[model samples]
Target: MDKPDLTRITTLLLDADGTLFPSEEPAFGASAAVTQAFADRFGLTGDFSAEHLRRTTTGKNFRTTAQDLLSRRGISVDSAELEMWVAREKEEVTSHLGEVLLPHPGVLAALRTLNRRYRLAVVSSSALTRLAACFTASGLDHLLPPADRFSAEDSLPVPTSKPDPAIYQSALARLGIEPQQAVALEDSATGVESAVSAGITTVGMVQFVPPGERGDRTAQLEQAGAVWVTESWDRLARDLADSTVVVRT
Candidate 1:
């Protein structure tokens, strides 16, 4: 990949779930039961366990994951039923996250520094309500208010999930900037792919990942087109500071 043009970057697009906080376990854990119930109702087979759900659908909204699973089984739900399940899953997941979510260590300070010079926005595959719940629970709602948050599941005319560039494209359009003028922070392969496909340079943030698994996750993000991988938000903040300063000089 070519080097990222840090000097030109005026916006920072952040992925919320694993990037800003550790919501994957609680969020996916809450989703597993709902997913299994849906599967049982439709006779869809294979794993819908929490671990499997996290692994397969970390960067996707529950609605998209459910639809994909059903489509694979040649089963399609009408809009009403689909919307019902989506709302149920979202309610469960958001409630669970509200009780357990916490911002990653150093993230608040890192974002404080990053915000001074960059326009920061959250772009995610989650529904807007779920995203708001997470941000609110983690005390990050103030940093990214409703207007600065873009959701693939709620912000678009038709819902989509990551690995689809729609959300990133939408954020760029809303911000009135070219893709090159933004940098994306993502923690999942799908998230990285989404940003990269939108022509934004991506950095992988893996601090929330388990220590033993970070290396693998880093490689996964790199293969998905991340230009850089950082283990912590503090490090990323420092690097961006240095790079932007160097460019200015």
Candidate 2:
């Protein structure tokens, strides 16, 4: 597919995990460990789905909300206990976080090139701290410069997040932008839905799901109204190149 016209595009919003890094396995495994720790402390086993839904929908701090929701649902965890459990999750994830981060080859150059032409922001459900660490480890730290990132941490007291479109809208709002003039790049069905619902052009950053995984997230993303679905970073580069996008004069 031909890349979207750069002249017509303004802001660029991105999802962090699979689109910027390698695959979700490392982050997923790290997160799974955190959730397991939450369960262990709370004596709960079935809160995974609930926690996932809460994070995706509300962008709450991962462990904090997991602990809160577990307690609300009658599980035995408390804020103090959750704190210790969070420490464990944090330590474990920090040690292996670097492993999950492998940016697509030439991505730095593409980002640098695009930086000259467009404003970039991260519109992920992930905590800003972890996402910042991943970007630093992957060498995009210089380009992304953690401060520019928009994430769950930015969701504020209410924990509002994606699939509801608030996060993307927040980014554009911060930039003083209109949705029709910007684009949101995502790798998940929920994210695409959130972006499209906000009236922003959405692009699906392709990712891998294990075989026999009943549902197809790509189709779901398309249904949610993505303007493009791709696994190729080269395409993003070419899109930028085609438009000769330069920082607005």
Candidate 3:
């Protein structure tokens, strides 16, 4: 990939779950419970522990994760049943996030600095309700407008999730900006693939990741096409502000 032209960038597309805030522990805790319930209902076998779910489906929405997991087990449910489970998971996770979510360290300071220079929008694989809850809980709702938050699970006509690139494409179109005109901050390979596949320059954020896991996660994000990986929002903010580009292999 070529170096991104920072001068041409006009928008910052942010991923919500781990990138913008540290909600994975609580969010995945709720998700694992809901997923286990779904698995029990369908008689599907495999671990649905919180860590396992986070490892397997960190960047995927509940709807996609449910279908994928069930399909792997050769279990299929009717649309009504699937919708019911999806709704339940969304409600449980959103509620959990609303109560426990907080912005990643330095996220507020970074956003306060960057928001003034570029258009800020959330581009996430989460449902809009969940994203809304996250923003409100983390005190980020004031920085990014509701209309600017794009959810792959709720914003599109046919709900989808990352690594599909549909959400990033939709977000770019809605913002009326070319792919090169925006920089995407992601924390997972699935999200990096989505943004990169849509032709946007992607950066990986791993501040919320465990220290021991960050090296592996950083490599995964780079392999998925992130131009850079960072563990500090302040560093990212400074780099962007100074128009410094650092590509890590």
Reference-based lDDT, residue 206, model 2: 63
For model 3, give the 10-residue run with minimal summed lDDT.
Answer: 240-249
Question: What's the CA error at residue 129 for candidate 3, in Å?
Answer: 0.9
Q: What's the lDDT of the predicted structure labeled candidate 2?
A: 0.66
Going through the candidates in the order shown, the clash numbers are 0, 1, 0
What is the C-alpha lDDT profile of model 2 across 1-249, one tens digit per residue? 454565667678888766777535565466676776566655766646433543342323456456455767776645576667656655666567765566555667777777777878888776666786788778888778766688754454544556667777787877788886687888777778888888888887663343333146567667778776765566776755666443542
Candidate 2 accuracy as TM-score: 0.76
Candidate 2, which segments miss by more than 4 Å at Cα?
Answer: 1-7, 46-91, 155-157, 207-215, 240-249
Arrange candidates by TM-score, descending: 1, 3, 2
Which has the greatest TM-score? Answer: 1
Q: lDDT per residue, candidate 1, 125-204, as tens digits?
A: 99998998899888898789999999999999999999999999999999898998889999999999999999999999
The lDDT for every candidate, in the order shown, is: 0.90, 0.66, 0.89
Best of the two (1, 2) by lDDT: 1
Most accurate candidate by lDDT: 1
Better of 1 and 3 by lDDT: 1
Model 3 spans > 4 angstroms off: 1-3, 103-105, 244-249
